[model samples]
Target: MTEGPDITFVLGTRPEIIKLAPVIRECEDRSLTRSIIHTGQHYDESLDLVFFDQLALPEPTHHLEVGSSTHGRQTGEMIIRIEEILRRERPDTLLVQGDTNSVLAGAIAASKLDIDLGHVEAGLRSDDRTMPEETNRVLTDHASDYLFAPTEQSRARLRSERIPDERIYVTGNTIVDAVEQNRTLAAQRSAVLAEYDLVPGRYCLLTAHRAETIDDEQRFGDLLTGVGRVASHLEREVVYPIHPRAAKSLEAFDLDVPDGIRIVEPQNYLDFLSLEDAASLVLTDSGGVQEEACILGVPSVTLRESTERPETIDVGANRLVGTDPAAIVEGADEMIDRDGEWTNPFGNGTAATQILDTITGAERREVSPK
Candidate 1:
């Protein structure tokens, strides 16, 4: 408990927060010197506490306050600030999760700084180079010292890319750990279902925040219209916890979010998880929600053209419905009334412990001669 690797976690955005939470808790439980640097990439700074506080995790040791901007500017600013933090903190390893600009910046900074880097949820590929996330994942995988892949499929992808097998550990994803642990916590403390007047299995939950879906006015309108039809067709309400960018897009595009869909402000992680657990269906463009929906035994429709988490679709837990009104409605109709009997392909929920044990038990890597 007194001694282990000193680690720094660099994360930005809600998905990173939710997924990395379990690993962070493990670090605390070990009394390891773990430092967190939150990039403040997509969150409102004031609401940052909602994630950390609700998760019962420590607030970040540092916040870079790099809010939304164009992709290039956002990522550039993050790298600059992240490098400053890593140089000063100089933790033995820097940990990053998933494929956000924050992850890319953190990976680049850590690798260049000569600090060992561990990437959780490594080797996932949507295989669409147009997506910034695809580029982030590929680059970060190459940069990482530890590639914690969630499934054999993911591990195979890394092998195909020639990433060293030794660097890869087929540790199950930490989201399994986070969701399994937090849903119980949500049951005890969260009143979200009651507060929203939602009866479990009678309503749909939606979260749409991706730029490719929402930033395009026509696509955004199509998504809303499709969800509206689903809600009206089934006489069930669709609850949307809108992201700031998507909300602004609605006003800027002068798009009408049709009836049968209730627009709500962004929810803290616990409240959102409670909603996910209770929903009859989930429609989302976010990658993390796709996994959460599968893990919670809720059927889902992914709003994007492709998914890195195809295991959800393969397991019969989800359908990949691109941004078309009819497709969305049809996917909803097919999934909404089904018995959700699909097996979870992610993990059995001990990923955080496995990842920490791997890092702790393995000796620090010596640098190759330049």
Candidate 2:
């Protein structure tokens, strides 16, 4: 099958949808044909459908309802369904973002079918194989023809792993573009601050749903307790827009929601970005949020032992604090009072254009490996 000029994106979770929206819009702006396939990995209406509506993106060309399931089942089904779409559409390139199972599946399906595959935000390594996301990203990099590393550090990691240099490009993270393009819209359109009756720079934001953090009751409890301690120490509220998975875990574990911490339902993309932009500090286990906090000049305390986005830490915008109450408290205290002096490492908000240009160039280069 000959490669076409068109492109297809495989995205499922909220981060994927948000990060890829800029590129999708770029495709539309250039009048280039593109297809979006939703793997349904994020089936919750809160996590999935509202993002497309909020971001003003086109409806997915295909939705493979591969909802919540064990890792094997979900990834396997996605591979099968994505393979079907690849066969039917036969697009030139299949692009996937982040470290989700959907990316891994798309990479596998496209690689097996001889379709040129691109992994956006590739070459990230937490170096912890226990984390499924680490595995997903690593495998996706090896299988991809174009590895869009978000930073030079990421490009170095790909070199260390022996990924051919020709395959790697240090195109700054698309999160920068998403944040730059949307913050004004969020500020103008979202009333999340008033809806919560919170004052800017007087409240903290919290989000923790990674399996390593929430799957164990002890760790999750400690994280909540620590966040609560910080909230009390600062006399500020810690607002958690609970992810559906974290909510279920709380119920299953019978964990108590500590004082000084208010739990809210999940928020849409714009609302959450609004909260992050105005917060005194952010505590999260999400890579996207870490990057967002950096871009928005908000200090973030990452609730994980390791992170793939070390650029956040290097810039003095974030701290990698494991879920220990005392440590979390200390990390929050250190970050809350800091001046927003760090440079935004992601880019000048044109990653989508650079990525699309690179892909277009790759087509010519792929014709002759020169």
Candidate 3:
């Protein structure tokens, strides 16, 4: 009757929560002690609380309330708050997912406190350091005690960076786990398609909230123009569920969203999943969307020059079009025409099990004698 190890899961955004839901479920199923720390990086109820309800995830043990700010300020505030929690709770391990500021802060605080740190979705690289997420990914990978890389390609990236092979495990991306667990529920319960009057395979799902895309007025305008062209060409609507930050940027830039593009507010997880499942194609600057689209066997046009999830491209499920209007239109058409026959390279719906096993196994190995 040895005690199971205590683990803390740190997350701050909807994407992180979605991807980590299965892991949390696994912990509960196993009767393992687990705590969640919500950083409140995404503070809105629509973007945050609704996801927890949709995923049936438990309430977080602590919410840091670290809302949006400049990168330095946000990360710094998270580090301070998270470190305080770490000192008090002192869990055996801290697990973080994705490349948000919260991940970076969690890694730093855990490392500083000498706690074992596990980074899910580790070793992804866009190779574009200018992107803040890229920087976070690199730093967190180097600092992590366990690197749960999603693919062999990701593992290779870590090895190239000289991360010790023993510390890295190819556990596959947990997005697969999340999608498999929720898709059936989404289909059964979500009426978003009918509510929006969107016919399956007749609309494009567009999401652009990345700082590199939405924060730049020129880039934002170009993205909308490109999507508008594709919508007109296909005689389809481009359904955009705008992030709150992007909404403010739209007003700030006074960028007129073109015709054929229907703007909508952010959606709950099930609704968004339903929209993605039904869309003819997806066009976005979101890393999560690219992964979800690929998993759902949907075609996607990424609104970026580079992507961390390059496997989507290698498998013919995604094309990067950047912000060029013409390129965007061309890329969308090409993807729309391509067959979604490419295998999902992410994983089977067992990543959360693999992740939990890895964590507990590592702990056992540390305690056992040679």
Candidate number of the best lDDT: 3
Q: Report the error of model 3 at residue 39, Å.
A: 0.6
User: Clash number for model 1?
Assistant: 0
Tell me which residue pairs clash in candidate 2: none
TM-scores of the candidates are 0.96, 0.97, 0.97
lDDT: which is higher, 1 or 2?
2
Model 1 alpha-carbon drift over 4 Å, by segment: 362-370
- For residue 332, model 2's alpha carbon misses the true position, in angstroms, by 0.7
Candidate 1: TM-score? 0.96
Q: Which digits, one per residue and each the tens of the lDDT, describe model 3 over residues 1-370?
A: 1367789999999999999999999998988899999999997978986788778889999988889899999999999999999999999999999999999999999989868998999999999999999999999999988889999999999999988887888889999999999999999999998899989988889999999889899999999999999999888999999999899999999999999999998999999999999998999999999999999999999999999999999999999989999999899879887677899999888889998898887433342110
What ranges in model 2 sit over 4 Å off? 1-4, 362-370
Report residue 116 deviation for candidate 2 (angstroms). 0.6
Kindly give the stretch of ten consecutive residues in candidate 2 with the minimal lDDT sum. Answer: 361-370
**lDDT by candidate, in order shown:** 0.89, 0.91, 0.92
Model 2 scores a C-alpha lDDT of: 0.91
- Which 10-residue span in candidate 3 carries the lowest summed lDDT? 361-370
